[model samples]
Target: MVLRIHFTAEDLLGTRFADGPAPLLELELAVAMRRRRDPDPAFARRHRSLAAPAARAIAPLNELVPATGAGPFFLDPLSAGLEDGLELVRRATRTAVRGELDRICRNGLPVTPLLRGLAHEDRQAWQQLERSLRAAHTALVDPVWPQLRAGFDTDLAWRGQVQREQGLRGMLAGLYPGSRWLGSTLEIAVAKQVEVRLEGGGVLLLPSAQWTGEPLCGPLPDGSLLLLYPALTPLPHLYLAERAPAPGADPDEPVAALLGRTRSAVLRLTLREPTTGQLARELGISPASASEHARALRRAGLVTTARAGRAVRHSCTPLGHRLIAAAGTPARQA
Candidate 1:
C-alpha cells in the first residue's frame, strides 16, 4: 500500500503548505468521519453534550455524504470560509455539479431529487446544502474555533521553522507518519495505489485537525497536488476546554502569572533563537531583563543559552518547544 508522487524541479520549488485550515474542508471531513462512525474519543467525550443536537441539526445532508462512496470525493471549487465555500458551490455551473455528482455516484445517476434536478433547480439544492453546512459548523466547530485556529497556526509555524532550518526536504520528511521524502519523490503509505507526476501545478499541503491516519493526496480541479494530512498539534476539544480560563477572565493572566509578562515574552521570542539584545529590543524591555529571563528559562530547562565568543544566543529546548506548542495557535487572518 504505497502512493508515490514524483516531483520535478519546478514542482519542488513551488510546493507550499496552506496558511491555516479551511472551514469547509474541516466540516466536510468531520461530517464524513461521523457518517462512517469513526468516533474520535477525545472529540466525542468533550463535545458529547452537544453531539446529539449537532447531529440532528445536520441530519438533512446525511444521505448526500454516505458512509461509503465510489471513491474519495473532493468539494468542487474549494473556498476557505463557510459562506465563501457555499458561494463557490452555488456559483458552480449546473454542468460542473452534475459531473462531480456523477463521479461520486459512479453510476451515471443522480443520488437524490435535488441532485437530479440540480441541472434545472440548483437554487433549492444549494439552499439545503448551505443550511446544513451552517448548522454543522455552528454546532461542531464554532464553539472550539479559537483553540482550533491556534492549533493550526502553531503547526504551521513549526512547519515554517522546519523549512527554514532543515530546508523543504526536512519539512516534507516530517509531514506524515507513513510518508518520506526521497530527493524529488515523496513516498506515501496508502490503502489505494496511486502514482502522480506533478507538472508545474506544485502542491498544496493542508493540515486538518479532523483528519486521522495516512495523508490523503490527489489532484485538484486546477491540477495541483493537494495533500490533506492530520495536524501535528491536534489539541482535543476536551483538553482545550479544560485549560481554557473561566468566562470573563483575562486569557493571558494564567501564563502571565506563571511567568511574569517580561520573562514569558522573552522565552517565546527566543523560539527563533535570538540574541539577548535582539530579544530585549523586540520586547521593548531592558537587555538585563531579557538576560535574566533567559537564565531563568535555562535553569528551568525550558531554554538553552549558549555563547559564541562575544555573542550569546538563546534558543528553546525541547521542553520549551512543547510549552509553546501547548500554548495554542496565534490569531488568524483571512
Candidate 2:
C-alpha cells in the first residue's frame, strides 16, 4: 500500500524535540541514573524548583500540565494519550544547565554569571552550591546516558540529511503522517510577521500566511500545532491553525471587506482571544488596518473586545464563530 503522508511545517518542527539529537544528549545522564535506579535527593529538589516556573509559563497554553511517557514521544492534544511532558523537560533543562556550569567551573572558568553576578567570595560559595547541584544531576542521569546518546546520534544524522535536501516540506512529510500543505508555494505568503519574545527568553514567530490544503487543511477539530525547534527551549512550540472564512462573503469584496474577512479568520484561529498586534501580523495588514477590521467585526456583532492588561484582546461571539464556520471555502482573491 502506498503510504499517504500528511505533512506540515509544524510537524517537522515538533519532531525536533523527540527525534532530534540535542535532547538526547541533554537527557543522557538522567537516563543513566534511572537505569541504575539511583535516587539522588538534591537533583530531585532542584528539579521540583525548576518545574514550578516552567509549569507557570506553560499554564496559559492549556489548562492541564503536559504528560511524560516513554522515549521518542510526541504530544498530540487530540490524542489525549501522551503524559504531560513539560515536567520532564523542566528537569532535563535544569540538569543540562547545571552540568554545563560545573564543567566550566571545574576548568577554573569564570563562574560570575552562574553566581548571579556576585563578588568573588559569593562566587566561590555559589560554585560550591553548583557542584552540589551537578552531583545531583549526574546521579539522576548517569546510567542511561550511553544508550540514549547512541540512539540520538543515529536519528540526528538521518534528520540532518532530510532537512538539507528537502527543506521544510520533505522533512515534515517524513516526520508526520497527516500534515497538509496549505499554501501553493513552499514559502508561505503572509503580510507582516513578528517574532514575539516570551518571558522565558524564548521567541514566537507569528506570520500571517494564506494556507491551502485538504483533509487537514479544511476545518479541523479543536486543536492547534505545537512546533518545536531543537536549538531553543522555554518557548519551543509554535501554535498554528487555519483561519475559517467569512460567510455570505462577496466574491468581489472590497479590500476593506477583505480585511474584515481576514480579521474574522484570525479571531477564529485564535479562539477569539488574540491581541491586535497578533491579528495584524498574522493578516499581513497594518496595526491600524487590524484595529479598523476589529472594530468592524465588533460592530457586526461577530467579535467582542476586552482588556487583557493594557492591550485589547478579541474573541468571537458564538454567532460569529458559527458564521465563519459556515462561510465554507475562502475567496480565491486576496
| Winner by lDDT | 1
In candidate 2, stretches whose alpha carbon ends up further than 4 angstroms from where it belongs are 1-121, 157-168, 172-334
- Candidate 2 lDDT: 0.36
Candidate 1 RMSD computed on C-alpha atoms after optimal superposition onto the true structure = 12.2
Once fitted onto the true fold, the runs of candidate 1 whose alpha carbons sit more than 4 angstroms away are: 51-53, 66-77, 107-110, 119-122, 235-334
Candidate 2 lDDT over 1-97, as tens digits, reads 1223233445334333233222322332233222232223323333454444443432221211111111122111112111223233323333444
**Candidate 1 lDDT, 1-334, residue by residue in tens:** 8878899988888798776677766766666556555545545555456667677877755545544322224342356677787777667665666666776566333377756655465577667767887898887667767656765665576567667866887678667644677777889777667788899998998876665545776677777888877665443631343464323334464333334445556657777788988987786757765676676566445678889788799987765665555556331211
lDDT (CA) for every model shown? Answer: 0.64, 0.36
Summed backbone clashes in each candidate are 1, 27
Highest TM-score model number: 1
TM-score of 1: 0.65
User: Candidate 2 — number of clashing residue pairs?
Assistant: 27
Q: What TM-score do all the candidates reach, one by one? A: 0.65, 0.23
